[model samples]
Target: MAKVLMKGNEAIGEAAIRAGCLNYFAYPITPQSEVAEYLAKRMPEVNGVFLQGESEVAVGYMIFGAAACGERVMTTSSSPGISLMSEAISYISGARCPAVFVNIMRGGPGLGGILPSQGDYLQATKGGGHGDYKMLVMAPDGVQEAVEMTMLAFPLAEKYRNPVMILGDGLIGQMMEPVEFPNNLNKEPTNKDHWATNGMDTRKSKEKNIVKSLFLDPKVLNDHNLTLKSQYEKMKKQEIRFEAYNTDSDYQILIVSYGTMSRVCKTVIDNLKIQGIEVGMIRPKTLFPFPEKAVYDAACKKSCKKVVSIEMNMGQMLEDIERCVKGKKEVSWYGKCGGDVPTPEEIINHIKLLLK
Candidate 1:
């Protein structure tokens, strides 16, 4: 199939359709409203459900209800809206329902600007809601990757029976690119016979499945938490994903980044190479099961002098990089938040100062 020119948000909606996701519930917000707009028009044609909830909070539960019945459901929102939905996210996590949510991040702390920013790193990767739960966070650097990852989220969610999050910024949500949907993304809706509460027809029917987060027994709750932890550990071993650029040969500096900021870092590296300054990069695709070992190995390269992290927020991923490198190399950061993105020239200047 020929690639089609598409905005990131619209492409994601189409990807969900191709992936056999038949139910979508969301509220409109800037930088990501196009996803809801696109799905609203397309879902009816495909006989899928596309509902615009009264609020993000309401949408979150709507996702949970549909997913509990074993539906391939999804929702999209920006920063403040995501914050509002965190409570339901926590419930979904505790209940172990399979759902996919996308966050086209904007500057935040409290209703920050609606421009591109990676300010939700901590919120998405770390525990955003009130519990000991983690999301499978995938960060895509471009529109095409966003489409691919959004398509992948459904299968991954079903495979693990957990919520998966696609983490991108306003830039990715708004940018246009040529993308081709996969030919084999047509998956049947998952069977919920074992765990879904779709109702029983006869006495021979199996026991009704109960979906809830409440556990009055301390020991049972502890066991549940441990079970979730085991799933996370398994994902860390089996699902860690990243891409290395200009890393084959030795380089003077190692740059760590993700999402749209990583694209800018690539330009900086290419321009610096023209000037005879060698640099390399590691772009992480999965944020929760972070490619920690990859970052450590790249930073430990013999010719690599120092490690630098460039982000659109105030150094959120820096902590993860530091944890990965384990102080073997000095780690530094450069960032611009509140709707402003650093230019390639600005990033190169930071690299020069670090080299000095």
Candidate 2:
């Protein structure tokens, strides 16, 4: 694997191709336009399809169409554009279509700004569209994870028959970092003629496989919900992933963060540690299949006192931290939104206040 300097957005597009995704469709959006441009050049070289849809809404439906054909497909866009595609995204979730949606988030409530912001943390984690469903959200800190996690996403999406979101902030999308490409994708997407609305084939399921999230009867909905709950439980066991830094050093303060903010938090950890202040970090890679057990274990440690829930949003995941370690540990939140970035020194100052 040879390392090459690449932006996170470009890495994701290339990784999708490397991961055997031949169908690409998306509308242009700031901070993520590189993804479309990258695929435009790369897909043609490989005889793959690259379509610039008329709108984000059209692109999402195109994803549905390709997934229905049992094809490995993907799309990329930023905040408000994603909002426009919510209806289709909900449809994709309901259909249980196996596809990848890359969201390089920008500031938003509505056309907020084009700077880095993990403002969509709640939206991505909670099935950004609608209905009672969840998306497998994979957050990447740098270009390497941007590619690796995307490669991981296709298989994971197929394994669970769920749509996966590669959630990144503008910093991750625009910042250049060294990344190593896979020599070969080495795997083909599983044949999904079973339920795929693709033409009836020998591998089709005996009954009409209706991909749906609707159950009219209360009992049916309950059973479906129970099944979904079971899936979440399994994800917690199989997919709860995070990185621990300086955690084993008996730190009294723990910084819980994800995406770009976590990188800033890391610098703060170094500053605090040098000043003889005990601080640690728990950076989550998968936000939905949260690392609740890790937080619980940290809370049980007498050395751990307070947990800081930091993100680029107005404390959405903060509620999640409270649920994970409430009563057992005091949880606090510090963040900015609409494209505002927090400096490492500021994070250190915040930690200093906590340590007081």
Candidate 3:
């Protein structure tokens, strides 16, 4: 397929459509509002439903309602907007509804700046909402990857009967890059009628499908949670995705990063290679499954003495890196939050200091 230059947020909106998602409900916020802007006009052309909710909180439940009916549904928002949607996200997870959420992260604890940040790593990978639930999280480094991940999120969500999150930074939302909509990604959703509350008559089944998150019975709720747990375990085993760069060489240090931050690290690694300072990096594509084994193996390399977690946040992913390394190698964090994305030169300097 021929690639067309497009803004990241717009590409994400189109990608969802290409993936056969027909329902989009979201509230506008910085860095990701363009997704809603693009989808609003496009959804009508495709005979899809596009409605902007009063708030992110309302949008979250809107997604839950569509998803419960087994309709392909998605929403996009920034960090603070996602926070508002957390309760509904938790409810969707508990109900075992399939849905997709794209988070174009902006800086924040509360209404921070509107610049790119990786501060929401924990919220997406760990549980953003309450209870024992995991959203399959994918972090894309560039616009093309963002398009691909967004397209893939739908099937993955339906496969696991859980929410899937496409975690990108502001750069990913604002930047323009050449992207192609894969023809194969647009496939009909399957087996939804069996479980979805679409309608008994429509499905030609007498069984009434109940879509809900509230389980009052203690044993039933526990069993429901266990089922969710098993799905997460299956994802860990089968869906971990990552890119290992410059790993063949015997490197002195390993850098673990994701999203836009990892792109800077990649550039730094290449530049360092010219100076004969070999640095390897593992760029995680799936944040939730987290590429744990890949990180552990890379850190344990006899030639690698240190592992550094490079991110746009104040070391949010640092804890995960530390756990993966398991004390075999020292793990440290280098980051700048609130929209101050570290440059490649800055990353290089940090590595040089580490080597010294």
Listed in order, each prediction's TM-score against the native is 0.97, 0.95, 0.98
Which candidate wins on lDDT? 3
- What TM-score number comes out for model 1? 0.97
lDDT of each residue in 1-356, candidate 3, tens digit only: 79899999999999999989999999999989899999999999999999999999999999999998888999999999999999999999998888999999999999999999999999998888999999999999999999899988998998999999999999999999998888866467656875589876788677888988889999999999999999999999999999999999999999999988988898899999999999999999999998999999999999999999999998889999999999999999998996989999998999999988
On TM-score, the stronger of 1 and 2 is 1
Which sections of candidate 3 miss by over 4 Å? 204-206
Q: Comparing candidate 1 with candidate 3, which one achieves the higher lDDT?
A: 3
Q: For candidate 2, lDDT tens digit of each residue in 1-356?
A: 78889999899988999999999999999999999999999999998999999999899899988887778999999999888878888887767778888899999888999998988888888766767777788899889999999999988877766788889999999999999997766457775764377554554566666666677899987887677667667777899788988889889888888888888888888887888998878888999898888877776678988988888989988888888896798899998886878888878888888877
Better of 1 and 3 by TM-score: 3
Order the numbered candidates by lDDT, best leading. Answer: 3, 1, 2
lDDT of 1 by residue, 242-342 (tens): 99999986799999999999999999999999999999999999999999999999999999999998889899999999999999999999899978889
| Predicted model with the maximum TM-score | 3
Tell me the spans in candidate 1 whose CA falls farther than 4 Å from its real position.
201-205
